[model samples]
Target: MINNKKYLVSFMLLVASVFTSNGQDDMDKFVSNLLQKMTLEEKLGQINLSSGNTGAVLGGGGEGQLIAIKKGEIGATGGSSFESIKKIQDAAMESRLKIPVLIGLDVIHGYKTIFPIPLALSCSWDTDLIERSAQIAAKEASASGVCWTYSPMVDIARDPRWGRVSEGSGEDPWWGSQVAKAMVRGYQGGDLSKNNTIMACVKHFALYGASEAGRDYNTVDMSHLSMFNGYMEPYKAAFDEGAGSAMSSFNLVDGIPATGNKWLMTDVLRDRWGFDGFVVTDYTSINEMAYHGLGDLKTVSALALKAGIDMDMQGLGFIGTLKESLDDGLVSMEQIDQACRRVLEAKFKLGLFEDPYRYLDENRLKNEVLTDENLEAARELAARSMVLLKNENNILPLNKKGKIAVVGPLAEATGDLLGAWVMYRNRDIVPSIVEGIKSVGGDDVEVLSAIGANLTNEPNLRKSLSSPFAMFMGEKMVVDERSLEVLIDEAIAVSADADVIVAVLGESTAMSGEASSRADISIPESQRNLLKVLLKTGKPVVLVLLNGRPLTIEWESENVPAILEAWAPGTAGGNAIADVLFGGYNPSGKLTMTFPRSVGQIPIYYNHQNTGRPFDENNKFTSKYLDISNEPVYPFGYGLSYTSFEYSDVEINKSKLNGNDKLIAKVTLTNTGDRAGEEVVQLYISDPVASISRPVKELKNYKKIMLQPGEKKEIVFEITPDDLKFYNSELIYDWEPGEFSIQIGTNSQDVKTASFVWEK
Candidate 1:
């Protein structure tokens, strides 16, 4: 019987060596050998992405993967554990090539040591730190057997209403591009052949962030010039850094859906910018093209392939349909071969061909994943992302001796701080805010708490989808007025005895991310009313805003004495927030996205073009709003440091420069306040006269400096002709010979100015 089994295995090996594949020569030889051993069905199996429907992780995974892999029906799955991925690999070995199954996960932020969300990281303005954060994420994720991450989303969004804005580097293409490269390097590291990192997918490939109405997956429209100059830089940066893959955006670019836009995928992604990676559709994007009125599965699949989409993710378009489409002249063998080779090359680069079970190391998972060091790093990152929105009367840096009334939906809620996209978190271990505060405050600080309101009162949003989403449907975020009043009344009664009120208010996990955006970005009405009652108690009301997006909080900004803009600090968020509140650490965090005074200023940003009638305090008819100020309530790149820094006069190395010469701009920043603090000295350039319209101010460079109380430092920034370059109507990326105004200051609008000229 053993001899028969051996003979049968040999026969099976012979049968495997018949059909299909090629990239790098060594890689090509290895893939061709593997493909020849794979049956036609097995060759076709490498393009599908299935996820288990357990819904534990952020994006989720596919079930029945083992059965599918056995039948050579699926190539890869989007997410899985090391053990599960190993099982899939085992199943793949039963096929001819013994090809390994690729695994993908949403390893955004740190995998285990959950850092501040992407939005908060952008505020740090430190590229090296951002890269290190991604490296930490990869270390933990790889320990869990994840080979790919859907991350480094480089969308340039001007709208704060868009919730996913938190997941990207902020609005400037130059800064965004810099951050994008850092993150890609962080994710991929020096080598994917090693076990410490995974492939990075530069995402929303074309222009998903420019969603119409700032709604998730909404239609997008922009001029070609806008695409080239404003949004595409970060993606190109990622590609230039050798990103392994690209995930097409859910929305269209110009008139075409990104996945099906030949001009975007072929011309721009492949031809113009020269990105050589395979393109994968976002979850079910090709199937959902019907919503975009693109066509049925067959037509859309054909269109996507022809447009250069290499893989279909969760769309079911590339399975059997892709092969038939190939035979019908809809798509050619070359296209299929090209895509297959790309996928195969990725697997090869992952070192899976050398050892398919490389990621299944049990010891690594036990020791390297979620270690205490990572948690400490996460705590530090969280603390850094928290911005002090207000601190009237020195109410913040809370006294540990004071009686504290901590009340809100999120104050004591341990469950939510983990947040969405936290598939890999050790759910129970992350300290809740209440737990964190208690950890340090102890019995010395009397702590009182109340859930004054639920996250939202709405009962039915996408009733069939998720219940948490129902609450954010309207103005009444938490609907139980009497219940809210009872809790608020209790909190008020407690505050009457306490010295201060630490009122934590913000959205639930469901209120921000994909399918989570608000037209009215504000503190939920239930919480707002609760705050009003709390304020009436005459206690020091400190607002701790835990939101996923920048909210419009004009009234709160004016009335509240102290406010903390904590953008959903992940995992150990509660403890991190507690650290900043009680003077354990000073708050140095700043805003990456703009905080609007109202929703009317939906697209408010620091880098807006100088309208023909630009808003001026002196001009009544010049681009002024009828009632509201044209200025944003809170500007982008705007965040307060613990201590104040005074800006000195702007100094330039030279008033004029000839062609191809460089300029040095200098500013003296003095720590004119009592406490040691961090300050982001911003440098913006303005083109007073240009062939085309230009922004009133463009953030060119900035330095985040830490100083002693009386310390003063001179910051010098180098400027080449490259710094002044812009994409003109003719699409040339170069600087125009002209006069440039330099403004140096604390923030965008508040600044000291000087002038320089690049001579013709």
Candidate 2:
């Protein structure tokens, strides 16, 4: 019977392989035939990605874009409304080739039905939930006539000062890789031909997260070993999972702009990683190469094509100069043909050739987009994304029937909660924090609300920092005319009669996104003062942060009775926050990024190579901070739940193992508290001795499990030589036989350690 089952499985695998091979063969023949019919100008046109709208990223769009579509001078367009997309598709049908124009959008976290920001979502440590969120995003985006998404931005970010960190999974490469694979699976699904599934574009191809000084579009310098071992895993993982496309970043890699980096785009992504997807430049990045001192527009366009960039995004570089370059012998006809073939192949795989309007169905738009089910999922995801940073003396799970004072600038905010990268949403339907409290608490709860402070004291700074999106949406930065003292006095008076205070404060919608980096990542001074005064009223205060990146909240940690990192919890953010506060749900989200105690610790992270002189409290000459402790305010993977959990010492099956042998590590976890909750069991592996210096520990694997009150479960993890491998100084990835420490715990800093030995 066992032999028969094995034979049956083998047969099924063979059948599936043959089916995939046949599909590829068909796609190649179709794309090749279409390429032969194209003129040199037409070939250049196929690789040109124009913008249909002006929001999100900077690009050119207007009536000219429609004319280009009709003339077959544009292949793809992004940032367009459903109505606009229909018109664009109509123009494409009128062209000579009748090729469908691929509609793309930056569907980062969610579409119309917004979920928590990516950083917040990573805190959940639930890949299934993350993938589900992506699936919903794809469904909504595809329903709105978008066939592609520039998402799953898998750049591994350790520096919170980089505002784009909000778009990626947190620090650890392994964790980011898992999230990357899940996102691809969710967006692309098993088949891109499905109407609800859109092609996923893994973005910022090279290292954009390791920007110098955590500044946007800054130069990135790193050794090849560092790239392979530290930051390149997530991008490779997304591509391995069959993401259909990639986007070059705005930054420079190895002193060259990523848009024209041959080593990064071709050698690593294609030659080493075997990524078959077409590469697109980030918003006019090809033209910006001239500013990078590369050459003139035509020279840079030729260089970009030679670097294996398949599509020019809104630069007009390929369309405007590729023909001239081809004639000058700077670029070859074969190169242009290859680039154009990739784009057409992508569309062919999406089944656009058979039905260009497959994703433009009006019925799907009406029935699928922002449905009740999607909102409910968003609410649940938002609740799970919240990390309970502090719950001193168990101040959370506040009684539902109390005089709850909800005060802060974000208390009644609707748009700010959606965070960045949200181009399309119905802001009118978003519920405010106070409204959620009232609705969830029912008639028994009396909710007193007040905007205790403005988002910032400097109105001019706020106006200057206002995103261009505000102008597009016909919105203005509305500043409160009331004095800070007056607002604080009113807040104090309102909270005097309340039993507890839920202070919703943090960054506005304009903060912590692309080009929105901050020197100070903390609560604004006005809001901090209000929080300080609220504490003086003898009321237990819950600091609910609604920001994108991890914030420095040392003062709040020491003073506030409770704290929650809400992270701009999307459209249903308010409802989710209310549910967690009222004990309807227990927070299981953990911090993916480290929260430093001060701005001085600019690049703090959990996984770092220990110096020769490691920090020792007993030694004065050690590498230690003179003013503040070296420890972060909140370490990575740290989150508090309503219930408590106790972990037993790690038990190893073998102290010594030979080549290809698997070692088993087990930990018995018990829910010690009297409430049901979930815990993320993190596994870390450390190489005490390696060919080169290694991080103190690296997150290898983790599992999220739920337990009833007082229940116990034995969690097991399997380790092999593969789990202990790292890139040496020579850029060779392999394991060195040595002592390895196995860590099992809730967070990176707090763990139970055991040792094992492995040999080749």
Pick by TM-score: which candidate is best? 2
Inter-residue clash pairs, candidate 2:
none
Best by lDDT: 2
Where model 1 places Cα greater than 4 Å from the true spot, the runs are 1-24, 32-40, 51-63, 458-482, 617-620
| TM-score of each candidate structure, all chains considered together | 0.93, 0.95
For model 2, residues 30-129, the per-residue Cα lDDT tens digits are 6776777688877877898875222223222356677777788889987466777777777776777777788898898899999888988898898898
lDDT of 1: 0.77
User: What lDDT score belongs to each candidate, Candidate 1 first?
Assistant: 0.77, 0.86
Shift in Å, residue 63, candidate 2: 3.6
Instruction: Give the residue spans of candidate 2 off by over 4 A.
Output: 1-22, 51-62, 467-476
Q: How accurate is candidate 2 locally (lDDT)?
A: 0.86
lDDT per residue for candidate 1 within 1-760, as digits (tens), equals 0022433454346433431222366677766666656655565577766542223232232336566666666666755576566666666677555566788888878776788778877777777878988999998788777888999889998887787887887778878888899999999998888888899999998888889899988989989787787788889999999999999988977677888889988988889888877788899888877788989898898888889888788777777477778767888776777777778789888877656666666788788877787778778778887888788888878877868888887787654565556655464786767778887786798888877776655454324125544333212133335665577677777778888988888776666666777777787786788888889888889998877788888899989999988777877788888998887777776676677788887788888776777667886778767877777777777777667788889888899899978788888999988888888888888887877887778878888898999999998888888778888898788788889988888778788999988885
Report the alpha-carbon TM-score of model 2 versus the true structure.
0.95
